[model samples]
Target: QHGTPSSPGELAHHATLSFSYLWAGDEWTFTDARGAVTRVRVDPAIHASNGDLLRDLAIAGCGIVMQPEFIVAQELARGRLVPLLADYRTMDLHLHAVYLSRRHLPGK
Candidate 1:
């Protein structure tokens, strides 16, 4: 991934990640495949206070928010958030990027 670092002032290989339904809500109402809802937690989202405010919103018992793998892989791996209903079909988006068009203007 582009986030990875190789050596001093150098970049290595790159990898593409994936994203899906970005589920975020101030209040979360979890339900099972049988259509049963469960209790919800009411706490201030820490991540919201930090850089990724939306992340804390999700951690604070908000609705399941899905984001790109690259964007959340670290948080997910660290158990900060849990994936819900993996079997269910979620949303997806097609993203593409190109080199900055404004490059070589003066900072060269």
Candidate 2:
């Protein structure tokens, strides 16, 4: 029912939303303009493992979700979702590709 959080401290006043096992703890870290890092933990009103579902919920005005830009790019472009905390930056996500060793591969 309230608007988006403009700062980390404001997160507590609003429903800090999240999704996925990676954000299971409902803790979010952000860097301020001065490069000061802050971590905010909240008991999410809703939690799920799917980003899409979370995005949809956020669009439906459930709460503010910390989702990837790509996941909500379309919504943001269409003015469905407005970005919050422009002054804070979230941590980068590192993804690695894993594969079986050549020796473990079966002959075709």
Candidate 3:
């Protein structure tokens, strides 16, 4: 491996979900109770305040992030990033709405 594995044992940093009407996702800093924060002040070139970027950072080994299960379900199931704490699962919800929800219903 090129980089070091995420040291969850050192400190279990938690993820926070942001609710903004303009932006659905954001890559916030993973600040643990011990005050160890990472991926917050990162490269400007990779400045991302969205889900895609958050996943990118996670894959890139920058730091851990709280993301929707759909984004990292396959990875988790495949052992890409082992669960920090199986009992402690965190996620961010993306408020999605379809203009015609009933019209597209299956078996309606």
The alpha-carbon RMSD values of the candidates against the true structure, listed in the order shown, are 16.2, 2.0, 8.0
Runs in model 1 lying further than 4 Å from the true structure: 1-51, 102-108
Task: Kindly list the per-residue Cα lDDT of model 3 for residues 1-108, writing each as its tens digit.
Answer: 223335433232333233232442343334455555543321223334576666666776666555667777888888775555333323334467767668667883
Residue-level error in angstroms, candidate 3, position 34:
22
Clashes of 3: 0
User: What is the C-alpha lDDT profile of model 2 across 1-108, one tens digit per residue?
Assistant: 556567787788786567756544678889998999998887788988888999999998888888889899999999999989998898887658998789977899
Candidate 3 local lDDT, residue 9 = 37
TM-scores, each model vs. reference: 0.41, 0.84, 0.43
In model 2, the runs with Cα more than 4 Å from the true position are 22-24, 99-103
Candidate 2: 10-residue stretch with minimal lDDT: 15-24
Model 3 residue 50 CA deviation (Å) reads 2.6
User: Between candidates 1 and 3, which one is better according to TM-score?
Assistant: 3
Look at candidate 1 and give me any clashing residue pairs.
23-65, 23-66, 48-53
Better of 1 and 2 by lDDT: 2
Give a tens-digit lDDT track for model 1, residues 24-99: 3323334445655543432322223233545555666543344556665778899987654453333344668868
C-alpha local distance difference test of each model: 0.42, 0.83, 0.48
